[model samples]
Target: MTVNSVLVLGGGFTGLTSAIALALRGVENVTLVERAPAWARVGHGITVQGNALKVFQDIGVVDEILRRGFGADGVTLFHADGSVMMRLQTPKTGGEDLPATLGALRADVHEILVERALELGVKFRLGTQVVSFENHGDSVSVLLSDGTTEFWDLMIAADGIKSSTRPKLGITAERASSGLGIWRGVTNRLPEMTGGIAYPAPGDEGAYKVGYTAISATQCYVFVLCEPQRTPNDLPDWQEMKRLMEPFHGEFDWLRESLNESTYLNFQEIEWIFVEEPWHRGRVIALGEAVHAVPPLIAQGAAQCVEDALLIADYVTREGDLEAHLTEFQERRIPRIKGVVDASLQLAYWECHPGSPDAQPGRVMAQALAELVAAP
Candidate 1:
């Protein structure tokens, strides 16, 4: 295939990063299609680890991201009764010599990415969605929700966890629930909280896990995990979520109070999906949450997507054979990303069985695997 213009589906972090990367490599024509009426992020804060930070730096958006974000050196794990369990450090890697991790609102990061993509001359077609595509050997014809069709040399799907393009590509992956759901929010009042704390409870049925980090002195991000259940659609029922967090009321009183006072909260169900065999077919390729949607246990979901964008751009720009390039992309990333998925699942299991001395080994194993995969 003679590659020229590329069509990108979805305008989230992955889609934006992919477009920016393609433009940076001098790919003249690239169009980003988003289903939403406007470009916006739907979540609270996200943790950008070192590996992801490196990618951002390479893409020329790290400084802006860090300007609007906060960094942390390590994460501290605690028990439900305010007892310290473990403190894991995220040290800097050799390449960048920057901070270990960064925490920022999703909107800020998305804005930086979109701004860079726009600056690179990538076209943004918001309110437009790719309904279907016909791969015609040499080119792919993309059908948009606006009742228009366009042909492109390549198509990349960066749509999120519930991607509309996945089914059209004949990719079948089962998303398994992790038996735990999370309630996340950001508070303007600081309750004298410590940075990077992951607290696990004592049992499997109703274990409470909390992760706290300071976005600013007066602003804090808190994420609590509990048993999975149906949540009403109206404003995330902060009061009911407080009720579910009653067990940790006395233990992490500040967190409980934060939840009670928080006016904005979002509920997320933890799930993981594995796409069988090839990650790409013909001219259509799925990246980010569209390919492997894992739980937030490792906090590498978005980062891995960014890595995919960088690697894909590099492969296409350097390699002549398109099929061989896609094959190499899958082979190079599958084992590494799969290890991350497995390690995250293991950590989720350990969090489920907190306080038990037996779970310590699982935690240790997870940390080891993380280090191994995180290593350059």
Candidate 2:
């Protein structure tokens, strides 16, 4: 591609990572835009697996993340009454020295990536969006919301699952829902809580699951998954959340007591989108959620997106035609992405159809992690 200048769209985890990565690669004149007016920290937590941590380390941000985040060796499965059934040791794929997993407040990660990207000399354009773009085969001309048009040798569409850039490319992808919804909140961390617990929930015809993990020394992220009649904004109140917690005991006791009106909640549908092969057309290419968005069942969404950034950056930095560069990038990514997206969907299915005798969510998780840790 013989890239010089580059334009990165969106400023989420993947977008920011891409921009920072490009800058770290010494790509001068890199510009990143976000539709949002400003960068704000989001509340909630994100579980970053070892693979993503490797990417962070490569980008020079893992130290800050580890300082502010909680590290865990593995997670344990339990009954509602807190009887531990099994402990799954997360693979330290990044390296034996790094923790198998880390849980950080989503906002904290956002801020960390943004700060690092900015410091690396990546110019961020907040409150700006791509109104349109033209792929000249050699370069891409982008029309911005602020009323300016610019061209670059390589254009990365790290926008997101609902990427405006994808539709602009006339690539329509399908997203599947697991018929599951999740309600999440952040609360004070519990004493001696190192990892997390996932308990099989009762009362629903399908098996529902509830889990919580420490995000920091003082806080943790709590989540509930189940088949809901309809999507409602957050739990009605703390009372409702507490009722859901009734089936949980032991480690969940602190969470139940910590539940109060002041607690913030977020509710969302569990969905996955599969963007087809050939993730790029000419100079415009898409990655991350823009191409493959899987359920959080396996917590690989960000990890996979990180892989996209790392791989795309690796290939794009080389000298070649944009077409060849993108093709080679997809060739290396498709197999790995397929394993992650499929395994995530499988685990989601198990959560939704708890009685399915064929379900093997643990096995799926183990296999996927093994593949992720093996190599890029």
Judged by TM-score, which candidate is best?
A: 2
Task: Go through the candidates in order and give each one's C-alpha lDDT.
Answer: 0.75, 0.82
Q: Supply the TM-score for candidate 1.
A: 0.90
lDDT of 2 by residue, 211-327 (tens): 888898888898877664433446566666676677777777768788898898776777778876567877888889998988887788999898789877778888766678778
Instruction: Residues 1-376, candidate 1: write the lDDT tens digits.
Output: 2466899988888898899898888787989988788865666878777778888988999998878877776777665666767777755531447667787888889999988998999998988888789988767898888899899988999887788778777888857788788888876545455365545444524436667666654676677777776455453477766665556533356666766543578877888776756877788888888888777776778777888888887776664778788888888888777877877777777666665566664355446335633543
Error of 1 at 327 (Å): 0.9
User: Which window of ten consecutive residues has the lowest lDDT sum in model 2?
Assistant: 198-207
C-alpha lDDT of candidate 2 relative to the true structure: 0.82
Q: Candidate 2: lDDT of 193?
A: 70
TM-score of each: 0.90, 0.95
| Top of the candidates by lDDT | 2
